[model samples]
Target: MSFFYNYSANNQGLEIEGVQGQSVFSVAKGKVVYIGDTFKNYGKLIIIKHANNYLSMYGFNKNIFIKLNDQVSENQKISTIGCLDNNLSKLYFEIRFKGNPINLLKLFPNIKLKQH
Candidate 1:
């Protein structure tokens, strides 16, 4: 599917605008298979395995509320937005099929944030 950010700032992974304590919701039904902080640029991260062998990756979260193997529904709250090492709040989202990253924006045209 498509990914949507709640803000109008730059869409770059490092430049995205994420508000602290804001809930990060699941875009679709899936099973959480990974949840933890990354050692590098990703910060906190979570991975959800969806139907048809699709996986959604949510990174730069302040906290991960769900655990591995947890079933999550569409729009379900999963985590809170976090920041980089520089302390800039941002969420890095991705959709993958099998193991490859897919451009999710193509799937949700209506929800895309406009460029300023």
Candidate 2:
């Protein structure tokens, strides 16, 4: 039962800002599929493959706890928000089903997101 405040996302995923040192957790148990820091705009990025043909991406992370092909459990801490432009740290998260983007809230009904 995790929650986020003051966040926004478009059709692709949720954009959470001002979460500097907060811990980013794995939404569901899965195996690390990809981990890289080549996204010019997103900084370090991590991708995980879960059951039911689902995938989760965590972008712009400051630190990563697991490596590629590692197994992770639901709610496991994977990374922390990374510093962005102007020294502001934020997190970019996405959930996809069969390679198609899906609303995280709709995908995981228990996690709550409230914008202020």
Candidate 3:
């Protein structure tokens, strides 16, 4: 599964601020299986295979600093933030459990969003 953000005239991917030039750290210690441009729209992407048959996808990366089969530590920088073909600088992040997409926000209870 995938989550899509509305792209209006002003709503660019860069809306996800504080992530620009920020390290795309690994959520957990894992082994990198694929790194590089896997999707055209995503620009550069990286996939990590972790324990318990889990995998994470990070897309829209400006640069990929890791290689296939490379071991990555938890919170390690694997790639830099980038934009889609539409020039939206957003980081497409996803967590898959057995090839199923899960809401990443549910995993972190400490992160709270202010009410509008």
Using all chains and alpha carbons, the TM-scores for the candidates as numbered come to: 0.76, 0.78, 0.71
The better-scoring model by TM-score among 1 and 2 is 2
lDDT of 2 by residue, 1-116 (tens): 22453234434676677567689999899999999978665689999999999999888898899999999999999988888877967787888889888866766676666554
lDDT per residue for candidate 1 within 1-116, as digits (tens), equals 22344342322221246677778999899999888765455677888999999888888888787889999999999999876667657777877788866644566556546342
Full candidate order by lDDT, most accurate first: 2, 1, 3
Per lDDT, the best of the predicted structures is 2
Score candidate 2 by TM-score against the native: 0.78
Better of 1 and 3 by lDDT: 1
Off by over 4 Å in 2: 1-11, 105-116
Q: For residue 71, what is the lDDT in candidate 1? A: 99
**Residue pairs with clashing backbones, model 3:** none
Lowest summed lDDT across 10 adjacent residues in model 3 is found at 9-18
* Cα RMSD for predicted model 1: 5.4
> Candidate 1, which ten residues in sequence have the lowest lDDT sum?
6-15
Report the Cα lDDT for candidate 3. 0.68
Segments of candidate 1 deviating more than 4 angstroms:
1-15, 109-116
